[model samples]
Target: MSVRDFAHFIAIDWSGARGARHKAIAMAVADAAGGPPVLVRRQRGWSRAEILEVLTDGLPANSLVGLDLGIALPFADRGAYFPDWDQSPPDARALWSLVDEMCAEDDHLCAGGFVDHPQASAYFRRHGAREGARFAPEGQTGGRGRFRVTERAQEAIGCKPYSNFNLVGAAQVGKSSLTGMRVLHRLGGRVPVWPIDPLPGEGSVVVEIYTTIAAIAAGRTASRSKMRDFAELNAALANLGSPPVAGDGAIDDHASDALLTAAWLRVAAHDPAMWLPAGLTPEIARTEGWTFGVA
Candidate 1:
């Protein structure tokens, strides 16, 4: 496939926490031509639907959208996303379909339905002391649960990642991942998702990204990746060779995440090595999916 010279790079710091309009859902954009990343702001904050609208109708052609979420669950480690379950989907696309179908009634694209599903709940670590039987770390009493191969690679690169099966705790991402799958399914090929869909000759494409990778590339430690003000953020932007945005004082960490990652994407997207990681076999790409920067 020919390499695409994407015209824009967008980063979305997504949220899974309950709410109609999430303060944590932040969006930012960087023009590939040059300059600092800018936040895509709204007076009342962003809703999941609004992000979907931008993806479907508002985005410029040849944009590279980086969504900060796990696109799929751990499959290679367990041989199935839901082992011993009848409805376990065979691949990421089907998995997205399953999540969307199950979560159809979940307003705001929330994943509460899938988390509480009779069979599906058994595979997840949920809140209120509801750790499913399979939630135990395999061959161990307790620890982080199963991880996709790409996640293991992420750890290898010094980025701490959490199991997407985990629904409780502040660091867990199961809710967000499941919610993102619904959006991917709804995307319906309007914009291709990398790995899941091969890159086209010319056009926009979406890729799953772990924002922590961008933070690490900007010389920030994973533990201190969250930036709360313009001063701290501009430092990281400088590290990525991006000009500073105009701002100061307290800012949402989610906003900082989106802005910094947008700038990071603009620089990182051009690297040929970033697209092909050793861990991303065709099977793994179809099932577990790779984070864009893990290599």
Candidate 2:
């Protein structure tokens, strides 16, 4: 579809922590007609399955859905997602299938099984001091672990991105990205994932996003991106030229994140450059997907 054709912009602040329902999962949508983005709050919190179902059929036609997670593992640096594994999948599609199949029994779409797999576990840094032998295969000491080409592009634009291979810290996205892969695999092409799946002419599509990028676009430094109260959120919204969301006092970062990103997508989606980043090769798009706002 044309960049401006998306009828609605949706942003999901996702979580990969183990649980049947996750309070950290937040969703917001900004309409093409203009207004403050609205959050899709759930009383019992959101389940990965429920979110999948929403992507399957619950969305309005021609909506642009943004999921906050790394869509694929590092490939360009090693010429393979799992450089040491003979059976490592060739591209993002196969990698998603592999993750889904391996983590089939993992409840709430968790990726515990894959991370703990004898071979797969060797590539990831899991909890409990279980640092995989190959977590830093290239012997690149200190700093962070490996990163996808898209992530490198994200870093180029003033965003501090963690390696999808590192699952240790509070900011780590490895687990969440893996869990998201499971859901993407199950979607079965019902909703197209951009870059990996070419943008369609007239339908909804999914894309990876980093909320910090949106926050930066709203005039906050990446280090000071998280807004904890209504005052801060409204100030950021003003920077984006969006109307204030009614509220006061404290607010969950998850909700504010989703809201601002939804608004950002509304504006960012109109730019053709976002869909065609200089670093995005066909090889990279198929193997390591690109983030929507990175360009």
Candidate 3:
């Protein structure tokens, strides 16, 4: 089916926790012609089977899905960086090398690095990594052919993971919030994932904040320069908190703060001059270019 024929898009923010405090997958859907996105469902503490079922049910044929978790690409052969979780785990160096190679080869693939290093481990502590760091044999990384996945790859697989691709400035300020918005915007308005707080009854104000930003970003209701719009919106919706709305109470400044940070990232990704709050290096700013300004 043609890209235009694809009717809906879904973004899944995954979590491994089990309880009321656990996050549910946040979902947003938009029509092919481009319109406002609607929040369809938010389920807290879903199981793998539930997630899979949601994936299968929500994603119609020809529709695209952008997931927060990694999907493993089946190797044509095996490589040096493959994680040996069953025996010896791969080191940081090996994992980095593999990521560097993969990223250099494919623009669509993201290199999050190997999961063995202290730094890498910290970065991906929540999201699980793939097993077997050993590289597949020559031509295994899909050098010339299409990447393949085994039919039995039902388990959470780790492949060339994709980053949020938000503007760099946003990434620096509120990485999670901005990245989530960027992914949602790119998917044409699909909420990236569900949000839940650490405490069982704490509630999910943060999720609402992110989803609101995603909706606004996708809807073009606010621009990169007008972050205050999001702030004001959040302030207005502070009460009536829920999966898609902030609880009723005093306005939460945190939402505005995060959205502003993300807005700066979006601005910087498009025009470096818009970057503010300082401290963002030229190198980091340059990397931000890859994620900004795609409709």
Give one digit per residue, the lDDT tens place, for model 2 in 1-295: 2565889999999999999898899999999999999999899999999999999979899999999998899999999989869889999999999999999888889999999889998878877877787788486644477888888888888999999988898999999999999999999999999999999888899999999999999999889999999999999999988999999999999999999999999999989889888999999999999999887
How should the candidates be ordered by lDDT, best one leading?
2, 1, 3
The list of candidate 1 runs beyond 4 A from truth reads none
Candidate 1 on 1-295: residue-level lDDT in tens?
Answer: 2355889999999888777798889999999889889998888999888888888888988999999999999999878998889899999999999998888888998888898889888878888888888876567644788889999999998999999998889888888888888888988989999988887778889999999999999999999899999999999999999999998798889999999999999988888778877878899989989999987
What's the lDDT for residue 151 in model 2?
A: 84
lDDT values, one for every candidate: 0.89, 0.92, 0.29
lDDT by residue for model 3 over 1-295, one digit each (tens)? 1112234444444332222222344444433444333444444443334544554344554333434332222222232112333322143222223444433432222232223343333222222323221322333431222222221121122112122211123221112322232222233223222211111122111111222233344332323312234345443223212112333344323233333323222222223222221322332222221111112
Using all chains and alpha carbons, the TM-scores for the candidates as numbered come to 0.97, 0.98, 0.32
Clash totals for all candidate models: 0, 1, 31
Show the lowest summed lDDT stretch of 10 residues, model 2. Answer: 136-145
**Runs off by more than 4 Å, candidate 3:** 1-5, 18-21, 42-45, 73-78, 83-295
